[model samples]
Target: MKSLLSLLLASLLSVFSLPGLAQTPEAQSLLASVLALKPNAERGEAEFVAQACSACHRKDGSGKSAGNTPRLSGQHGAVIIKQVLDIRSGLRHNPPMQPRVTEQSLSLQTLADIAAHLQALPISGTIAKGPGSGVARGKELFAKDCAGCHGANGQGNQATFVPMVAAQHYGYSLRELEFIRDGKRGNSNRAMASLIKTYDQDDLLALADYMAQLPAPQRK
Candidate 1:
């Protein structure tokens, strides 16, 4: 499994060289392995707490906005798995998460379990929002630029690995948008980066605000 994971990491690195490319064979294999595992949410909850994830993400998975941490509650399990694997493989540059998301600390099964647990959690608690001034423009911008891929309601496509941005904190969203625009976020989708690069700071602020104000998706 470790060898397989190593190969997966190499495949992920190749993405940096070929943006918008299809997944490599090794990446597909790792995804299959993760999908094959029967995630144990109960065990995941324990690991979430034990791994000190609760410290930043909160016990409920409503992440800290002041810290620029994103809300993880109700996110798709596959998306979570992909991001964590990216972090572990150095495809994503998250220094704080790097230590905790190591291969030894989170094996594929444990990672899958954690993702399931987080996905099952309800998205509750107060989300930090942007100022009201830009909401109208933000809404317009969202319709014109973002709604196609992210959906009209920002309920991201789980199968495509697009994260649910509705109800996310404005501060975090703005920061990440800036990072993607500036090419600072290594794992960002190239198309998104290019599109966001066209936006000014105020556009980003409005976009983030609009996204933050969107209602959270109703979970079954």
Candidate 2:
């Protein structure tokens, strides 16, 4: 009986533990469109504020609230481009962001420009730290489960379009992890979903807080 239960658990774990899937055709097209244009970072910055992105993300893209809005500062241009496209296409569901991106009538060039400006911003800002939550346990889990793809320092791999997770808002990051774990997020990564499923709410909270305190990805 014990062997059977353990086998079942292992199988379930494997189901969620698959590697990241190949990039979608839509992602490829978005990348191609961004590369085809010459973006103006200055203009992009202006538009980002004018478009009300700063309302939730802050003028610097550091997120207005922890675990609710994400820190976009110093994130890779490729990752930002992919996420924006996903939101626009309804591959990712963000009600507040959807109308903003669509109603603004932003063109591909404009999108790329915004991405460029965001990438140029420094990744320094105030983020909420979880007090006496689960720092030690979170650090251990992060190194074991998260460091491989997100980097030892959470810098994220631009080539793979992984967003930098360090210094992100604790609340927002926790929300995203919960959403992915529950299969609520549309652009969910299967591997992450599976891994997150193993953690309880406290575990996720600890992880988010730990990540929020890490240094932001350094500029090249």
Candidate 3:
């Protein structure tokens, strides 16, 4: 009975301790910098472009239109690194992204190396726009559902883990909404999940269209 009880206690302790094992952006960054194990920019660049990351996000970090993937240009390196880790940890849901991030290895060094390379890319100036019957409907949905944390303008609060959406590539923005709806993105973002849960397919599309017309976010 004592042995069985001890085993049960150990199982409970492991379950409770998993969160502490999650990699932090700071941890990944420090390790990459200190160990000099970050993949060279050249290697990372090749890997990024050659790998499927470029397909949805664009080669110049401009972003795609069909996939609703976002512009990856000029994102904070730490934030970028953490996102990949979050997806793997199921803190964010992304079955598609999970495979890629964990494909080679889900180590912190690999995440940091990819982030470093992406951060160095030149920004694309292609702003998004939308015009259609659904624009007004999309705007209404944004006002009612999305504007609180993402701002009325879709400029997100990074501190809140709310990503900027104003002038984000329509494809990328739509993708984000889809992920939220499917419970594949923003696992840690209660507000986002709640907002998305109330959204239908048309609502998601409209939100994407409306956000496409907003002004670009100011980078730090």
Candidate maximizing lDDT: 1
Candidate 2 per-residue lDDT, tens place, 1-220, comes to 4442244334333432345544555555555566557779999999898777888888987875636688898998767877887788787878778877772577788888898899999876787666646878889889999998899999997656677888887778888988988887888777778899999988898888788888876676
Could you give candidate 3's per-residue lDDT for residues 1-220 as a string of tens digits? 4442244334333422345333455544443342334446666667676666888777777776555466777554544755675676566767777787773654556555566677666656675655455679998988887787578877664333345667776767777778767766654455456657877888878877888777665555
Using TM-score as the measure, what is the rank order of every candidate, best first? 1, 2, 3
lDDT of 3: 0.62
TM-score of every model versus the real structure: 0.88, 0.85, 0.63
Using lDDT, rank the candidates from best to worst: 1, 2, 3
Candidate 1, residues 29-117, lDDT tens digits: the string is 67657856888999999989988898999999999878369999999877799888778877778999998989787789889889989
Best by TM-score: 1
Alpha-carbon RMSD to native, per candidate: 5.4, 9.9, 10.3
Clashes of each: 0, 5, 6
Cα lDDT for residue 47, candidate 1: 89
Q: Show model 1 residue runs off by greater than 4 Å.
A: 1-24
Query: Candidate 2, clashing residue pairs?
Result: 66-171, 66-172, 67-171, 67-172, 68-172
Evaluate model 1: give its TM-score.
0.88
